[model samples]
Target chain A: METSCHDALLFTAEHPLRLRSGATMAEVSVRYETYGTLNAERTNAVFICHALTGDAHAAGRRPGDKRPGWWDTLIGPGKPIDTDVWFVVCPNLLGGCQGTTGPSSTNPATGEPYGLDFPLLAMSDFVTVHRRLGEHLGIERWAALVGGSLGGMQVLEWILTHPSEVDNAIVIAASSRLTAQNIAFSAVGRQAIMRDPEFRDGAFQAQGTSPDKGLSVARMMAHITYLSEDGFQSKFGREAQSGELGHNFGVDFAVESYLEHQGNSFLSRFDALSYLYLTRVMDYFDPFATPDATAALAADPAKVLVVSFDTDWRFSTEHSRRIVRHLEGARVPTSFREISSPWGHDSFLLTIDDYHRTISAFMERAAA
Target chain B: METSCHDALLFTAEHPLRLRSGATMAEVSVRYETYGTLNAERTNAVFICHALTGDAHAAGRRPGDKRPGWWDTLIGPGKPIDTDVWFVVCPNLLGGCQGTTGPSSTNPATGEPYGLDFPLLAMSDFVTVHRRLGEHLGIERWAALVGGSLGGMQVLEWILTHPSEVDNAIVIAASSRLTAQNIAFSAVGRQAIMRDPEFRDGAFQAQGTSPDKGLSVARMMAHITYLSEDGFQSKFGREAQSGELGHNFGVDFAVESYLEHQGNSFLSRFDALSYLYLTRVMDYFDPFATPDATAALAADPAKVLVVSFDTDWRFSTEHSRRIVRHLEGARVPTSFREISSPWGHDSFLLTIDDYHRTISAFMERAAA
Candidate 1:
């Protein structure tokens, strides 16, 4: 899944601006990576948005990393986000666990971590940066913009906020809004973080302490939501994990191992503030709030694709269609597909042969 | 989902004998509520095993409680486990949140709340108590022992430990072994409780303190795994449960509210120690340890009825089938059925119609 960075420069985007909260961030650095070389006509740009914990690194086995990109199998030389012909660009999301200016990033003014002090970034703010990234490359519009889960939300928000910035938008396993339940989960996570003695109320920037336990608990909670019972049961029922429960509460279940891995690993490259900021973004997302707000996107609706998985209880297919219905009602050229995957919402990260084919075909059309 | 329990009698089983672990136990007190009349032939007695947090009260609608017994729909006077026919007995499991002796029960020796000092009881211990309860009532054996989740574990163990104790067992949304993942989850819950300052290393007994935060976290963690993602998506989504979370991680999703309700109410009635014990019981459940273990069952082999819900990913129907296959191979009269529900592992508690019929059919066979 490795493509030469210098050779695969399909496009580049960057910008700096004032946020909705009246906070100005200058030269907001957005270092992104792309796949495939663009034609002279420059009409084949496909903007792929990464999710909360994702990065510009989408489909590759990067050096120094033991594992490949989150969805390397699905996007390679001839993979779904095929670099064979279509230009696919993936940027590290703003307020993310990756290399964008996030909570973990040093605050230029304070010379300290932004933590919660980082201007409260919204999902719209994320799309705004995305639009700027697209504009910096001198591209009038993208052939398509795609993402899954939270990434999917950015795609929907991108279309809703700047409908003309792209020709098509694909949202997979994304929801119309962050329900109270989702927020409650995020809140609990945040609570876990804030309550962590190390967190110091998000002001622990100077301490360089990561609220590992709190974050682990948060991730554990999120992990539970991401998979279905069929997935969890098939993966890890009451099966004993290890260390004999330590005669005390230690790690036991495979699920716990998985969640602990996610949480601990998250603290390494991810910022606690980024979790706070990004979760807030998801909580505030509303794809169908108003006519001028979201319904109005149809006037020049970007061709949109919404896909959902049957077993993905996290952001079920119904969520995908809700986006499609709004897109269609707005006279947007939209395609809706419901794929079946027993892996739950995480299927987007897995290369279901059918999913790959579908993505490849969609990219082909977007390129044309 | 309401019924009068006037005809039912509550029975307390003797807690005599040293448990599997040499611990001073008096007559095992099993505070059970029974419905329906036992026939002269004494062949109509049926045992109902309640889930982890369920109680001996099966089908009573309190004037202001608003919520009936979790199994009110199925165990009513004319319902499937109909009090009108087979004599039904629902016993408070050995270590439960209800009237049964749990962590909250007074220690006869210490004359104080047992709390964590309460002996760590296993699933087999629950079965032992059930057997004693049945014996005291002159019930040579049950027509069938019906249970879901943890209760199902008891039913399975009852058949394996004392095959003659139950002619048939209806194990629902339960498993034969504690998956490593489930153990890990329980580990986190235990950790959460232990970490709470109020918990004081499970020595909160003398202080009159309860590990509210830890217990709540435990409940919150467990609650998330109990439902299907499809259930969460349909029920919560990013919707502002009651018009909130537009900006914060507060209770913005209905799922969060539901989880909160579960977690909050749990701390009130549940003993954090019992939660630890019961989950461990689940962790220790392994019905297929050795074939010889089954060879000892009564020559007629107890009839086994295994049931699971399609949506119960926590305990997939496959898990139940594994039990059916094992019991049947042992020449135990066995039946397997997978009921349909969207409630995930908790489906048995909510969707009782199909199970009601299944239990009724199995009980009728046992009566005959």
Candidate 2:
């Protein structure tokens, strides 16, 4: 496996970024990491986009880090992504708290954290940032783009926004647009953060406080959506945590304990305001809303592969089907397969032999 | 349709009741409503159980109310349950706040509201109370027992604990036990309430406060689980509430507005403590956990019908399948059917023709 190191790229005032929400920000910077070597033609570069709550650290371990990166299972030299065969680039999206210019970032104009003042983001903005990052890395055109969930949404944006930049695009466990249920979940999560007294209108940083409870609640809710009912059954199965009920409002079931641990651990690594902004961006994503939308895009048939998990109710197989249907209607030769898995929406991140094989074969053919 | 009126049934100290959690209460009171008349042979009594957040008012409206009961659609004179033909009884569950003895009820020992002091409950406790109500009504057994969700759990208890009393049991969108996902959601909901400072260790009432925000967030999270992705898309469809994105955390999408409305409206009608207690009872329900569980039960196999909705992910059709499997393993004659609908877990309460027909035909046969 090719070892990777984190790198930061600064987009100075000259590269002032304008967001879809009619807001603009200057001095943008994105943190990214890369593995393997870019070919002489720069045609073997594979961009790996991260989902919500993910970062530039897609694979491999950071300095002194005992645990490997989030996507280490699938992104190593001998793994499905096969870093030895292709240069893999993973960038933390804008509005992310992980070494990216987000709400926690200082506003050049005010010399303070952007907080609520941070301009709203769209998936296109992330793609735009990625484009700048790609240009900085001396990659004019890449071999392929791959992402799952929010990252998948970004992959779609990259194809629609800059079709000629990549040869193949793989969207895994994502939707063309977030459905009402997705938005509703995001809404509750945002409301939970906003209603937390410590949230303080997304400016809790000034008070040196964190909306830990609200953010924990949000993560708890989301963590449930990421697992299948079968997964939950096989993992927790109504097992009591303390051998006896607390007989009060305390953690009684093993699932509750797991959720609390997930929620609490998330608070240590994530920013509450960024959770708000990023989830909103997902809710606002819809490419086909414009007039002559699909027709207006650079129609490149045989350039897209869509994948879904059978048990992924969060962004179920139907969502992937809808995306494929949209691509087909636009005359794009799209290949889609719903892989069987009990991991729900998180199947893309897990080690499923069939899932890995499909992705490997697809990537191999795309490279060929 | 025959007009119905609400009635209260009180059990004084002479009728002291013990609960499954080793807690006992005196002067326990259960509110109920009846439609039609008990048959001459006392054999046509049909008991309808309400799920979480439900009450004794299962059908018809109060004296001056404009809206009918929640289940009024299927419980009317000429409707599916056919109140005109069968004697129908609906009682508020023991841990419910709808004029029933619950966390909001006054504690005989403390003389204050039970609140956190209220003992935890199990499905059997609700059944025991209903049995007392039945004895009070001079009805030896019910011709049929029908319920959905938590109500379905209670119906299972009725058959398992007092098998001879329920000639027919119909479980709708229910599970024999909650899976990890269900418990995770309930855990988040409970944490939302408990973390609210106003909850004050469940003594909010004493401080003249209500954990409205926490309770509301709980409701919002549960509401998402109650609807299918298709149902949400058709209903809300990423429509912007203000004609444009607020670009802030304020209600931007129509789904957010709708969920906020639901959460807010729920606050006025429900007690936070009751929500906590009832959800715990649901989390604790598991009939097959005991040794000799199936053989110990007085097995009357020919009297059970398990109904599920294809789109109900909260208590998905798989959960219903599990219940049917258990029943079959116990040599119980059970009919299981999965009806297609886009309403998700709420299909049982919606105007789905297939769902209503299944229940109607099953109940009719059960009564005969």
Complex DockQ per candidate: 0.24, 0.70
Put down candidate 1 lDDT per residue, B1-368, tens digits, no spaces: 33333221222235354566666566345677777788998888888888877778877665787677778777777666777877888877776767677777777778887777777676777776777667668899688788889888888877787775567777888888765446666666766666566776666866888777667777876776687656766777655568655454455566667777877888777787777777877776676875676775646577777888887766777778888777777787778888887778877877457767887787666656
TM-score of 1: 0.79
True-vs-predicted CA distance for residue A82, candidate 2, Å: 3.5
What is the C-alpha lDDT profile of model 1 across A212-288, one tens digit per residue? 66666677666766776568778865444673443334555556667667756766766767777887777777758
TM-score for each candidate, following the candidate numbering: 0.79, 0.93
- Candidate 1, lDDT over the whole model: 0.72
Q: For every model in order, what is the number of clashing pairs?
A: 37, 1
TM-score of chain B of each: 0.91, 0.96
The true-structure Cα RMSD of candidate 1 reads: 5.7
